[model samples]
Target: MKQSVTVEAGGARMPETTTPHHFVAGIGAGPANLSLAALAGRHLPERVVLFDRQSGPSWHSGMLGADARLQNSWIKDLVSLVDPCNRLSFLNYLVTTGRIFAFLNAQFTAVPRVEYARYLAWAAGELGTVHYGVDVVEVDFTDRFVVRGRNGAVATADHLVLGLGTRPRVPECFRSGTGLIEGAVLAEHLDAHLNRSEAPPAGQVIVVGGGQTGAEAVQCLIRRGYRDIRWLGRRHWFAPLDDSPPANDFYRPTYQKFFYQLPDEVRRSYLAEQAYTSDGISLDTLQEIYRANYEAFLRDGRAPVMLLPGRDVVRAGSTGGGLGLWCERGSGGRERHTAGLVVIATGREPAPMPLSAALHELVETDNAGEPLIEQDYSVRWKHSTAHKLFLQNRGRFTHGLADPNLSLLSVRSAMIVNSLADREAYTIRDEQVYTMWA
Candidate 1:
């Protein structure tokens, strides 16, 4: 049975009415979803509800590593981008935990990823509008959407926000269990597992991909006293990110002006082209890894980092106890590496859970299968005109580059709230009927 309830909006208290009324529902509780909640808390009427599949607020549980440091500036945290003065800002979080002065004195450019995770959890705790562990199973649009959850919880919302974050994009070669290549998403527990394992012979590890996670994984294995490691990436080598304070202009609200004007096809192509830089590790991390490896090399001929540029994993099969990896190099050679284990730091792509077969049929799409959304991030379908669905994180292609990452989360939240406010105003102007019509 669906739990019926109402919440306070502005100075008015809404009652638990059974009639089809306007509703806002968020499907996932990641940073993107929580950012939406923070925005809504300040602006959304009390009727909105946020849904998360996890037991609590966890942005990226798989990638959360203790030794891992954020690749972005500290100001890019949840609340700070939107309202630096807000009590929920990271500065406030630090002050609450008595780390403000200490952090300031450290002279570090970024905070630890674990600490940032804690900040997300703290922010969620204060928001209080989110429903954790209540995984949204299906979203359908009639006059309103009947959102079904895992334990038979059905919620009717006029709008549904899908923050279904990226699914790890494991390459085709590593997927088959029969292959020697193992696709391991080195996040949370998996990181600990890799750390605890006895160092392989010669302490050699093969890491593919050059993103922030890949760099961190390399750092972790090296710090754990591993010496021989090869970082085989698609690019020439890890390139530095132009993260100068002014370069942040690429991620600011003003940047959206240029992003929005681009055609959808251009937007899609741009995201694919720039994924490496926008999501790649900062220059600082690159330097740290290089210095550590250089120190190891100077101490002995043993270098912790090896660069295999233009080499891509081609095929994988077990040679024996360990694993044999075959790769095609930029030159005319097929390089083979045998390691204790092969780790694919290959990043993630957005994967949306299938809604009910019927529900899926109700939503319309463009030339691609992506949802055709209005400017407010509402899915445009012939069947549901009254219902407004705010797609949280799934609109990267439609909403431009700012939709997916935490880069524009604060301003993105504000934008979404403005859209929701406009939606509410329209409903109010029409005197949106709260009861069934004849």
Candidate 2:
């Protein structure tokens, strides 16, 4: 794949592109790109637009359970850390929509996930840079970045920012020759599946995965009055998040900077050690589930949720009445359980970068075949510094845990903006430094 070659426009051969049309072509309209757009509104000289595949903006709608609450604080919104005065701030959304007082009165320990989704939609509406319904299939580059959608070259940019969020991890057992196994559903689609159900399912309901999503699936089942429910997790027990002050230090901008400077071996170890801080279920959520179980126990002789934490579902098959699953227990041996329906609450991985073959050949990658991203989230490509490619929420390996997290969203955006603008567009100030990683 040569740098100077005919690029495909839809199916037709288009001439090679030379001049840049947009300053930055952001590939996803999620929170990360939204943060960049919010801060770059006045910073960049050229036009900056984000193209999303969705008909409109939505954040984790499938997993927005009725009782689901965010593990992180509300202040971790799109533009607060760097630009609190930005119109897209979560506080502004609450106040503008006349829910500020009500929100304050409710005194939620953590804001509801549904509310956060709504806030994202609101922010998307306010930010005029997003162009929805454009499914960017591939991105090609010649002299300038060419972002192509399902149709043709939708936009060209001097720089590219890829922020396509993660996708749900569907296990092999759930898939079949034709399609997904019968009566098997991913956690993201559980709500819609339940809604469309003609009646309450008979027999036991099994939810696999011990993370927050898994717990939520169990809670949803309990709320739906599923008396016999089996909750399985890989861990020995459901782990609660370490949200203490010391744990939170890892999420700070100062800490992010420190973590970026460390060697790969040290960084990998630190990431493994601090996984629970970002990955574990919230303590409050666990308490809620336990309380619900307590209530069910008091109301009936048996509880609805039977937590089998150490069991790993090894095999699954469609049975006469339901589905039969074999679990490998942590203690020892294997056991079989049947379920009317199965909800896979397994985790997610970073989405694939849709770079064209020519573009991919130019970008440097690590031994794992991942693009070698710098501290500022810029991809080390075989191109001029004036033209660059940036990554958002796709730099956890390079930028520490905070890279994929919402804690330093605005700060990250600010760094990207400053880098592109070649000036300090936003002052990223985190003066208080109690613990030093260096």
| Best-performing candidate as measured by lDDT | 2
CA lDDT of 302 in candidate 1? 68
Flag regions of model 2 displaced more than 4 Å: 1-20, 177-179
Worst 10 residues of 1 by lDDT: 425-434
Model 1 collision count: 2
For 303-388, candidate 1 gives per-residue lDDT tens digits of 77887778788876666646677888877789888776567777778767546677667779777777786666667765545655
Considering only N, C-alpha and C atoms within 3 Å, which residue pairs clash in candidate 2?
Answer: none
lDDT of each: 0.67, 0.84
Residue-wise C-alpha lDDT for candidate 2, range 233-322, written one tens digit per residue: 989999998899999999888888888888999989999999899889989888988898898889886777888989988899987878
lDDT of candidate 2 at residue 212, scale 0 to 100: 89
TM-score of 1: 0.84
Show where candidate 1 strays beyond 4 Å: 1-22, 177-189, 195-203, 245-247, 272-276, 423-438
Error of 2 at 293 (Å): 1.0
- Model 2 CA lDDT for position 13: 36
